[model samples]
Target: MVTIALDPTPYHSTHSLLEFPDVAARAGYDALQLTPHPDFGPFFRYPKADDALVRNLKKRAADAGVRIPAILPVQRLAWPDETRRRAAVRNFRRIIELAVQLEVPVINTEFSGRPDELQEDSEAAFYTTMEELLPIIEREGIRVNIDPHPDDFVEDGLDAWRVIRALNSDSIGFVYVASHTFHYGDRATSLIPELGARLGAVYAADTFDHNRSHGLRYITNPPGNAVRVHQHLRIGDGDVDWGELFGTLAASGYFERDDALVVSNVFGEDETADETSRFQLDRIRQLVDEARSAD
Candidate 1:
């Protein structure tokens, strides 16, 4: 099983995402979640970024003493429009470039329902990205893990499976987010293994609210809404069924002798954003020790 870490992007620039490695180390997490261009801004597709930015990211990850396992861009790349789709591909490539520098393990992007290309052609786009990036990812020795978020075109395991199977490449796979899976109305326990070899990693969190708006608020700002619906929450606090979650992943072949990758976070009416994450990590450390024994 793979060890889990937290996605610190919710805290944004104020916190150096790489700085969380100490917290993860303290919490006993193994990796960190990163994104390309953070991909959601109107400026996500900047053609003018220098390679220094990428180099800085690599240096930052090294300084943190943790590795970047996945790149979860905030943008929705699964689109049906040709132009926007091409732009998305370019954006994808740029992030992958940085992942190579950081020696990151996966390039994690989400598939929103709105397509910039033909829906039928999404497979083509998926392949297009793979075809273009695989050589570089392989050169960098990184894998690309695309997550199926509720806001995207492929919002669940079935769609994620279809898209991943279409690519038929080892460099690409799925990053499972539990709250997102539950939002798709299917429990993750049932989804992880059906993915088979295409399963790359799992993105786990706890939450109460269940709206995309609430999720986005969490993404833009920590502890997003007064009514938080699951972008990031500490395990066991909200509505998650942890027992079922662990059982499913174990049965899914993700955990055998018991290695797990969980990026835990909780947003609330908190003061310091970093403290919010530290608190969440502290909580998860206690919960995981309670839930599973570390051999």
Candidate 2:
């Protein structure tokens, strides 16, 4: 049974951290993926969760009949600067501890390196940090999945997978965010199969191909700026091909895995989050069923 979790970012502003499970339940999700939140784990900051808070959160999720399959904490594990890189490593240790306490097996995150800086430097820093963290990840039995986010040191899917593979640890895996399809070289058909079992999670959100219309879909203030733009629009609202994406996933034996995770992470329609979430759930299930049936 593939778990379809909800990313409760749309309710971050309107609801409290403790209310996320209930919010997900109300939106028709039995599982929720915890993202960075001010009260819990803020982005690029040391986690703020304590023992009491972790206990409370676990109980809340249980009460709401929601299972927290994963947590996302965006620490700069690949910072080129020594000071920032060390700080990110420290932050990651705490994040791992939190994951253990919550009994969440997966930590989905980004390769938070500087794209403006030297990619080699960032990659070196990343490996250095991983040297210290991989042992702990293995000891704790937690899977840390990395996404090659837009504007990150390695945004191309194959390149990012290569970086992950270089770590040579089964504890490290890949996160395929659908919204980043274009940035990932739009190679889901090939990428998913290449990733194989190393693909730990899939985030379902639609995004416009910036490469479309001769790269005129979005215009920046300064021409050829370093800005990389993408949207987390509802599925089918943008350019991601659901049939092809899901079909590839099925062909790669993803749907047969017990730990398979597909997250509904549409962040552009917060005004209609409840309705959009329900729609996403149904649509995702429909796509998965259609793909599986065809397979």
Candidate 3:
């Protein structure tokens, strides 16, 4: 019943997002969750001219009744060195600037574990990165939501909390992926309650497959594989626990009408994409309506 923002990358890649943003608006979502892609050529790319185009595009979205609340930058943070780390931080600042202009509140990032950073004092490195990055987040008046994915250094809800606790920064938080928790931990259901407040956004996906995870790319450019832990699909098609999941979101004070759901289960049958996504959205709309009417 919390609000829904559809992650459009699953439905459309980098080049295809401009075209699909309107589709997302028409699909009854108020906001869009942007993804980062790496190899999206030099020009004519989606996020390439995003800075210059954001205002007008936001206006367009306004006309379409969709507002962008967050953009997920998952890849660059996973880079193996300080150089890439700093550059990614700068890029994240840019994303926050766009969010400010678009009136979005958060930019989702990864608590990346790159091969090198992990070998060293990961906890210290993570906080150090945040210490340097916090100024940008605060300057932009935005929170950077960093979640622990299985592929990343910080896995499971508890470790995610440990890192968040270690950093102890107001600007940095966690993105809860139920599938990630389920696949990578002892008891995902147990972790959800403890992680509720830390949960910045709910990344609802079906499977717990860590191999082809889809939400990891921070560039939003094309060609680079999105290190997705799960291939997002319609509600009933995957292994998520809907009853408890919905209950958790409903109870979480952070849940907002502006929250998003990035649909990516458009892989199977062409008909499946349309039919399944539509049905899922409809059901979600009903849930939202029911929640509102209850109030």
Candidate 4:
């Protein structure tokens, strides 16, 4: 079955790391994707989780009837700078250890490279870092899904997938985030099919097509400044074609996969997160059902 998980970022401020499973359960989720958190894996830094903390977190999730299918740790793995790239590799090894300890199979992350400066170098650095970490990942039997985040060196979805494919490791896959549809070249129909089983997970959120209205959805200062603008709006609040996206997933047999994961990561409306999360769960289920029926 497609595991619907909550990102739980909205509750980070109010809830402790150990309390996340209960929050996810209260929000109508049976699983939660652990993102970069200070208590566990902070962004671009060494992880803070000890063996005791990991054990307690696992127990908490079990008690709350929640499973953590994935963990997202944003590291500068593709940084053009050697020092940062080395640090990222070091941090990622520990992250893989944490994943092994927690029994989580997937680690979703970004390319984390500087595209604006020395794009080629960033790509090269990414490959170098992967050379160092892929062995550990494969040995541990963990899957790493890369998201071509906006502003990353490989923002285009296909280009990112090519980078992952060139690595030639099934341990690496792609994360299709709905909020980043435009940045991904708005090619879900083709991209999802192209990735096929390599599509590790899908992040559920809505975003406006910045390319619309002559790229005026958001205005930046200094006119031609380098910026990537997007949002993590609730479903139906943005321009993402829910019908087309879900339809493509269904037709591609994603719904039949046992490892399929869809995460609700609406970070815009924390004030109403509980209600929004519940709504997302119901709406996502509806979309999945509708897509399957149509398929």
Candidate 5:
């Protein structure tokens, strides 16, 4: 069955990481996707998480009866600084080691850098970092999934697909974050088939179309900047076409109903998290069930 994972962003900022598994289990998630935030320990630091903390986190997940399928370290791959990019590569190597210890199969990351920097410089840095980590990734037998993020050097789905193709490794794959639909393309469903088999994981959530002109829909002070804004809302609360998206997901040979990494990421800066997480989880289960029945 497709694994419904709970990302700690829903609670880690306000609550303790130690308490996440139990809440996620109660909410009916089968797996955990650990997200590193500054409020918690320095898990995202270049030195990586200490062994004791990693062991403790694994223990908590086991005790609560959920699996941690992946770990997401907020490392900037496209950073232009030479020294900074080297440090990021070093940290990613350590994260791979930690993943082996924690029995996590995948490590998720983003193509990150100063949005205003030269695109060529950022892309070159990212390629350099990945080339360094290639041997380590192969030896450790871990999968790496990358996503196009808002304001990153590569923010479009097709560009992200090109990066994944250029990597040309079986272990490297693309992640489709539904909340970024508008940022990535005008049509989310259409982009999925284009990525096709290269699409490895999905971060599930709903978001309103940022291009819409309704003044009451959203507000940002001091206008006339290039900033684009969106939120991860529960299903049906936003404008995503869930049915068409799910249908395309099913048609993609890379995505299997029996086993796919689908993370419920309905996180917000000023919203009650647990309730929203539970709501998203239930909605995802229902959708999966419907998809399977149709299949």
Candidate 6:
């Protein structure tokens, strides 16, 4: 079974951590993929989420009758500088501790790469940081998932998969974001089925083809510069091949059993929070249900 969870980025700007659970509940979400948002006080930098703060958040979720199945902490662990690298490792340790306290089963994040450092060096830095955190991660028994975020060093999902494969840990997995299909390259259609059980989660949203002239529909003033441009739009609002995505997911055996997580990360413009949340959650549930039935 697939559980449709909400990524509360849409309300990050306006809602507090204490208040977002109620918002998610009103939107009919039973679980949340808690992303680090500025309004979340100490949780914005999860390492700063002290014991008391973690307990408070746990209580808040319990009060709202929602479960926090996962937590996403934004940390740049690929920095080449020794001080920054060490700090990043330390922060990750604290984050794992917070995850233990919150009882969050999965922890996910991007493989942040240093801007000026060579790719090889950044990759090595990431590995080193993870090596440092491995002790804590192993001790706590928390699962880790990673995404190839557009601005990160490994922006391509296939490349991210390569890195994850290199790590070769059973507890580590990939998160395929639909909006990132283009950057991940042409093989996503094939890659989806190949991932099978290794694909631990899906961040479902739609995106325009950012390669063709339609990609030029929106532009930044300083032309030709590298800019991260993409929206986590509602399913049908953009060009995502929903049928193919869902079908491939179904064929991959994702919905054959329980504990599969499909999160609605839709956020672009001014959308009524409740409506957007309900629409995404319902659409995903319906698609997963139909796919399972077809199988």
lDDT of 6 by residue, 1-295 (tens): 5777889888877887767678889899988988876633233243555677777888889999988888888677776777777777777777787788889878887777754568888898989987887667767888888888887777776778888888767677888888877677745668877676778788888887677685684587688877777778888887678878888888888877476888898878445767888999899988887777776
Task: Please provide, for model 1 over 82-193, each residue's C-alpha lDDT reduced to its tens digit, 9 standing for 90 to 100.
Answer: 5766686676676666556556666666664343335566655556656665687777767767776654555657767777777766777777776665665665655665
Off by over 4 Å in 6: 39-46, 214-217
C-alpha lDDT of residue 48 in model 1: 35
Task: Give candidates' CA RMSD values in order.
Answer: 6.0, 0.6, 6.8, 0.6, 2.3, 2.1
Q: lDDT tens string, model 3, 43-103?
A: 1122453655666666677777776667766545545566766665666556566677768
Number of clashes recorded per candidate: 22, 0, 20, 0, 0, 1
Which stretches of candidate 2 lie above 4 Å from their native place? Answer: none
At residue 263, give the lDDT of candidate 2: 98
Better of 2 and 6 by TM-score: 2
TM of each candidate vs. truth: 0.74, 0.99, 0.76, 0.99, 0.91, 0.92
Model 3 stretches astray by more than 4 angstroms: 13-15, 37-47, 78-80, 115-122, 184-188, 208-229, 252-272, 285-295
lDDT of 3 at 28: 60
Can you tell me which runs of candidate 1 are displaced by over 4 Å?
16-30, 36-43, 47-49, 74-76, 113-131, 134-140, 209-231, 256-260, 265-272, 282-295
Q: What is the lDDT for 243 in model 2? A: 95
Q: What is residue 7's positional error in candidate 3, in angstroms?
A: 1.0
Q: Is candidate 3 or candidate 4 better by lDDT?
A: 4
Query: What is the alpha-carbon lDDT of model 6 when measured against the actual structure?
Result: 0.78
Ten-residue region with minimum lDDT total, candidate 1: 35-44
- Report lDDT (CA) for all predictions: 0.58, 0.95, 0.58, 0.95, 0.78, 0.78
